[model samples]
Target: MTVRAAQRQVVTERLAGHLLASGLSRTSVRQLAAAAGISDRMLLYYFRDKAEALGEAMGHVAAQLGGRLEAALPAGRRMPPERLLAEAARIATEPEVRPFMALWMEVIAAAARGEAPYAGIASEVTT
Candidate 1:
């Protein structure tokens, strides 16, 4: 990835971490940028707006979760319903994955409030 893309990923991950630690449902771009130790205008330059940045960040977390699920699937076979359900339960309840779940929920709530950037991300995660 390009340096800019890498920087965005770092910022997004930090923002998600901050939200999880603060138990916040949403965050302003300025607030996130401040917490991420970057200029607010830098955040705006990388992401059209707060919602887009948050969505991209949440997408990174979701991709990680998806990778875990893919690894857990049985080799050369579709994952059975039972296995899927068990994995879902594990992810939902596991402390390690809590931040990701929190970020996912936050993004979904944002999308519900007509946040266009997060709308597609929320749908993708639900499916």
Candidate 2:
């Protein structure tokens, strides 16, 4: 990857973890910069805008959650409903899952407010 892409990926991963743990809101540029261990200017250097940065973070979190679900699935057949429910319950109560749940809810709320950036991200990651 290009150095800029690598840096942005690193920041995005860190920022994703932070958002998942803390929940999303009107998280300021300064707050995201703090979570990313960089100045706001540098954060902007990596991301064109707050919405894009937030979208990238959401995508990363979704990828992780999806990876876990995929790993738990059977290779050649659909999972049974009971087993899927059990897995869903198991996942739901995980401490780590709570923040992502909050983040997703925030995204949904944002989309409900008619924010195109969030709606686009909601489609990208939730699908």
Candidate 3:
């Protein structure tokens, strides 16, 4: 990969960690850039826009959450949708998973408000 791509990945991962820890409450370009230890202009240079940056970060969070869930409940273990949701709820209570759940709630609230990035991200999560 190019040096620029690698640097973008590092910044994206830092943004993902920040999002998981703090949710989407403070996601201005400056705030996100600060979280990623980059200048706001550099963040824009790395990503197309704030939506793109946030989408990539939340996608990372979702992937992390999926991996944690798969570890706790391995694949090919089938259950009814309701039962699966219950199991997920139980798993969400675990400390490691709780932050993701909190972020999910924030995403849902943002989606409900018809917010950009989040509405799209929440749809990606649900569907």
Candidate 4:
């Protein structure tokens, strides 16, 4: 990836981590950018705006969770439905996953309310 792309990835990951730890409603992009040692202008430049940044961050979180799920799936094993359900339940109940779920739900709700940028992310998630 180009340096700028790498930087945006890092920023997105940091923002995801922050949102996961603090919950979505409480986070400010400016505060998160400062905490990540990035300039507000750089954050805007990378993401276009706070809403887009938040959507990108949510996408990052979703990709990470999907990776984890794929990795945790049994390989060449004939798992029973109950076992598969249990595994899914375990993943869903993980503490680390909780924040991402919260953020996703909040973003979707915001999108429903006509929140800009978030609508795109919510649509992405739904698709």
Candidate 5:
């Protein structure tokens, strides 16, 4: 990867952790930059806009949750959909996964409000 791409990925990972830990309430540009240990201008330099940055970070968060779920509930089972869902629910409620669930609810709330990026992002992540 290019140096710029590597740096952006690092920032995106940091932003993912920040979003999970802090939720949407503390996600100002300055706050995100602070979490990533960069200037606000540098955050913008790595991403096209706040929406793009947030979308990427949220995608990272989703990937993380997916990894955890996959590890907990491996695929290739022939269980019924209801059973599968029950297992997923049990796994999702674990302490380590709760932050991602909280962030997901926040995103859904934002989407319900017809907020920019979030509506689109939520749809993308759900599917």
Candidate 6:
């Protein structure tokens, strides 16, 4: 990738972390720009709009989490069902997993309500 493209990906990931920390609420463009250390115009330049920016950020967050999960699984070894369950339980109790688990539950609840954005985001992430 070009240097500019790589730089943008890094910037987007930093923005995604901020967005994920806000829970289910939307962050204003000004807030996002400030958090990103850029002007609102620059933020808009990278994204079509706030919703599109949020979608990209959240998608980045999900991809990050999926990478973590993939890293945890062994390459070729077959894990026993009981061992898998035990590892799963351990992960659920981990500090790193707590926020994600909470966020996922919130999304599931929101999806049940048929809410916009999140309902679709949740479905996309899960699938």
**Best candidate, lDDT:** 5
Query: Which runs of model 5 end up more than 4 angstroms from their true locations?
Result: none
Instruction: State the lDDT of candidate 5 residue by residue for 1-127, as single tens digits.
Output: 9999999999999999999999999888899999999999999999988888999999999999999988877877578889989998898898999999999999999999998879988998898
Which predicted model would earn the best TM-score?
5
Model 4 vs. true fold: TM: 0.79
- lDDT digits (tens) for residues 10-29 of candidate 6: 66887777766766664788
- Model 5 clashing residue pairs (backbone): none
Backbone Cα, N, C clashes tallied per candidate: 0, 0, 0, 0, 0, 0
lDDT of all predictions, in order shown?
0.74, 0.85, 0.90, 0.79, 0.93, 0.74
lDDT (Cα, tens digit) per residue for candidate 1, span 2-114: 99988987888887667666634446777888878899999997889886776666666677777766676645866779987887788677887777677777777878898
Among all windows of ten consecutive residues in candidate 1, which has the lowest summed lDDT?
A: 17-26
Each model's TM-score?
0.72, 0.86, 0.90, 0.79, 0.94, 0.77
- Candidate 4 or 5, higher TM-score? 5
- Which regions of candidate 6 fall more than 4 Å away from where they truly are? 2-4
Predicted structure 5, TM vs. truth: 0.94
Cα lDDT tens digits for candidate 3, 1-127: 9999999999989999999888888899999999999999999999999999998888888888889988978999888999988988899898888899999999999999998878988887776
Write the residue-wise lDDT of candidate 4 on 14-70 in tens digits.
Answer: 888877777656557678787557988888889888877877777778888778778
For model 5, the local distance difference test gives 0.93
User: If the candidates were sorted by their TM-score against the true structure, best first, what order would they fall in?
Assistant: 5, 3, 2, 4, 6, 1
Residue 18 displacement (Å), model 4: 1.3
Sort by lDDT, top down from the best: 5, 3, 2, 4, 6, 1
Q: Tell me the deviation in Å of residue 7 in model 6.
A: 4.2
What RMSD does each model have against the real structure? 2.9, 1.9, 1.8, 2.4, 1.1, 2.4
Off by over 4 Å in 2: none
State in Å the error of residue 123, model 2.
1.4
Worst 10 residues of 3 by lDDT: 118-127
Q: Candidate 2: lDDT over CA atoms?
A: 0.85
